[model samples]
Target: MSLQVTTIMLAVDDMDRSKQFYKELGASLGQDFPQFASFELAGGSALGIYPLAHAAADAGVPADGSGFRGVSFHHIVDGPEAVDKTIATAVAAGATIVRAAESAGWGGYFGYIADPDGHLWKIAAA
Candidate 1:
């Protein structure tokens, strides 16, 4: 069977704020509920957000973990200019600049930004 990941769900501290953050980023909203929200992304994939407690319960785990969750999201852009532009937009849309946009040693441009709930997103261009 072919394997593919279609969505990445974030366990956020506040549902309203997380929904607002992604909404401001122009994510097409979908499947909104009191405890869950989803965004229809480009292509066929999607993004989901829910309260941390709700997510923990769904996963049968505790909601007390902190620090890095050891996962990140990536967004590809057209070029270095687009990378810079996207990062800027993310900051304006309530993301913290984790890494300023710059040329990579691998000869590409990229940057890192964290959402309001500290979900890291790596914006890059090949």
Candidate 2:
């Protein structure tokens, strides 16, 4: 079977805050609701944000958890300069820089930031 991912859903404590952050990162709003919000991303992929408590309950898991989810979302940009600019923009939108943009060991430039709900995102040079 061939598997393809068209959407990524994040469990957020505050939907409004998460939605605003993604908007600042250039995602266009799609469907909006009190418990959920969807955003259209590049390449036809989509991002979904839902209430953490509801998500956990729906999945039959505990809602209380913290620190490193062991996964990160990546955004590719045209070049190293764009990486820096993206990082700055995220910070201005209330995201915390987990790592400063710099040369990557793989010969690219990248940085990481955590959104209001602590989801990690990597802004990398394409």
Candidate 3:
């Protein structure tokens, strides 16, 4: 199969709040629908937020519980300060600062934050 990801969808508990969170990170609203909100990012791709229960139903699953899921979205920046700035912005926008910006042992600086809907985001300068 020749396929490329055209969009990344996050199952959000609140679409409006999620849209605001992404907007604070420099994304602009691209589409707004009854059950979904899409954001146009720097690149050509898009970010989608949909109600968790509705999304799960559309995907043929029961949204009765939660788990780590271990999915992380990475955002690459130009330098350590950029990483720090991004993390700070995310924090100010109501994201949970999972890891404070710092030098990584892997020859770079990085940090992590969880969006309003608990999606993990890694900001790195490498």
Candidate 4:
């Protein structure tokens, strides 16, 4: 069976805060609920935000874990400048820059940032 990732759900401590962060990153709000929210993304994919406790319960896991989760989301832009611009925008929206945009060994520019909930995102050039 061929599998495609259509949505990525993040467990957030505050729904409103998470929503606002993603909105600032240019994601259009989709379904919004007290415990869950979704954003419409390019290519028909989606980003979902859900309460930390509820998300953990749904997955039958504990919600108190911290530190790196060993996974990250990637945002690809058109060029190196776009990479820097995107990182700046995210920082202005309260995201902490883990790494400033710079030339990657792979021949592209990239950077990393962590959302309010410490979810890492890698912004890179296409």
Candidate 5:
């Protein structure tokens, strides 16, 4: 059988803040609840927002994770211009600009942004 990751869920401390952040980035909200939310993303995938405490309980793990989680969400765009625009928009939407947009050594352009919960997103075009 084949597998697919249709939805990516991010555990956040503040639901309102996180929801607004994603909304500003053009994510259409869906299945929004007090402790959970879902956003429609490109390519038929979806982005899920959940409370950190609830997530930890669901996973049976501690909610004390800190520092780089050794994972990043990579967003592919049509071109460099799109990359820059997305990063800029994310920053303006309460996301911290982790890295400025620049040319990549692999003949591409990209940048990085961190959400309120420190979720890293790599905006790139290849």
Candidate 6:
């Protein structure tokens, strides 16, 4: 069997804030509540936000601590021009540029940005 990921649920401290963050990053709203929110991402995948406590409870484990761990979501594009457009759009939508756009070591154009809640996103064209 092959593994296919359909959704990614990030455990956040605040649902409303997380929801707004993903929305600004161009995700369409799916399901939402005081405790959680889900966004429709590209390729039929989903981005979800759930409270830290609840998420940990659901996982039957303790949180690793506050602040972001090293995790990133990505937006893949087609060319150098598309990379520029993608970065511009994400910036205009309120994402903070974590790293300015540049040529990647992997022979692509790439950049990094962060949502309001500090979630990282890598926008790239290969």
- In order, the Cα lDDT scores of the candidates are 0.92, 0.91, 0.89, 0.93, 0.92, 0.82
Ranking by lDDT: 4, 5, 1, 2, 3, 6
Model 5 clash number: 0
Pairs in steric clash, model 1: none
Error of 5 at 55 (Å): 0.6
Give a tens-digit lDDT track for model 6, residues 1-126.
Answer: 999889998887667766776787678998878887889987899988888899899999997665567778888889989878877877786678999889988899998987766778898998
Judged by whole-model lDDT over C-alpha atoms, candidate 1 comes out at 0.92
* C-alpha RMSD for every candidate: 0.9, 1.1, 1.2, 1.0, 1.0, 2.2
TM-scores of all models?
Answer: 0.95, 0.94, 0.94, 0.95, 0.95, 0.81
Q: What lDDT score is found at residue 3 in candidate 5?
A: 100
lDDT of 6: 0.82
Residue 75, model 3: lDDT of 97
lDDT of 4 by residue, 5-119 (tens): 9999999988999999999988999999999999999889999999999999999999899888999999999999888898999999989999888898889999999998999
Per-residue lDDT for 33 in model 3? 93
**lDDT, candidate 3, residue 34?**
75
lDDT of 2 by residue, 1-126 (tens): 999999999999888888889898789999999999999988999999999999999889999888898999888999999999888999999899999889988999999998998889999995
Residue 6, model 3: Cα distance from true site in angstroms: 1.0
Candidate 5 C-alpha lDDT tens digits along 1-126: 899999999999899999999999889999999989999986899999889999998999999999999999998999999998898889888999899989999999999999999999999999
lDDT winner between candidates 2 and 3: 2
Model 3: runs farther than 4 Å from truth? none
Report the poorest 10 consecutive residues by lDDT, candidate 3: 61-70
Of 3 and 4, the candidate ahead on lDDT is 4
Candidate 4 has which clashing residue pairs, if any?
Answer: none
